[model samples]
Target: MDYQPDGQTPYQNTHSQNMALASLILGTLALLTCGCIYFAVVCASLGIIFALLSKGGSLTMNTSGKIGLVLSSLGLAFTLLLYIGLFLYVLKTYGGFDGFMQESLNFYGVDSIEELYQMMGVPY
Candidate 1:
């Protein structure tokens, strides 16, 4: 039984594939820039968005999109965990956030907050 349909064919566009490709690229970038909190977060967020969009229409997603989602999630998780650990360590070691900041400035050889401000050429 051969059932041939009518003559109207749907428009074939590569937009979904492009989204998958973009997701992959952003996910890769998120991993690459893991040391930078801002870049890592931004790239991972964008990658996840693109991946979801690529997976929006159907039950299955392209391999690249799946990989992108995984990598992006891993990057975001690693970055968040790292920062949280560092924050907790700093909080434990120092009396408070302000103390930690002051200690950091002192470690950098700035005698006081005013000196740091002066070094940065901020009129205070």
Candidate 2:
């Protein structure tokens, strides 16, 4: 039976706000799980979005949501970059780059990278 002078009722209740905060907490926990980088990233992104939206919608923004957003985003970015770097390292270690360079050189009738190195006058 809460009333406002403007005859408008608040759209959110304490329970709903608490639930939202809990959701944010749970999402954050899920993000921290091992091998769940993608999931964590997604959860964090959603949490941030939800938190911002809740703030705009006149819902209280909890501290947990803020922390979760920051942690999750960082975790996601770090994990994503790490995964990309790992894949790149694997590709490079497996001779992917060297093979491609060798094929290109063969097309140009070069016997070795050393020949190109010599032509470029670059020391080994």
- Report every candidate's CA lDDT: 0.86, 0.62
- Residue pairs clashing in model 1 are none
**Candidate 1: which stretches are off by over 4 Å?**
1-15, 108-111, 119-122
TM-score of each: 0.79, 0.48
For each candidate in turn, give its C-alpha RMSD to the true structure in angstroms: 4.4, 11.1
In terms of lDDT, model 2 sits at: 0.62
Model 2 residue 60 distance off true place after TM-score fit, in angstroms:
8.8
lDDT of 2 at 94: 57
CA lDDT of 107 in candidate 1?
85
TM-score of 2: 0.48
Q: Write down the worst ten-residue block by lDDT for model 1.
A: 1-10
Q: Write the per-residue lDDT of candidate 1 for residues 86-124, one digit (tens) a residue.
A: 899988999779989888898879988899889989999
lDDT of model 1, residue 56? 61
Clashing pairs in 2: none
Tens digits of lDDT, candidate 2, 1-124? 5456677874433333554575477456545652566666666666666556545444455666566556556656666776778768867765677766777788767798888778778898
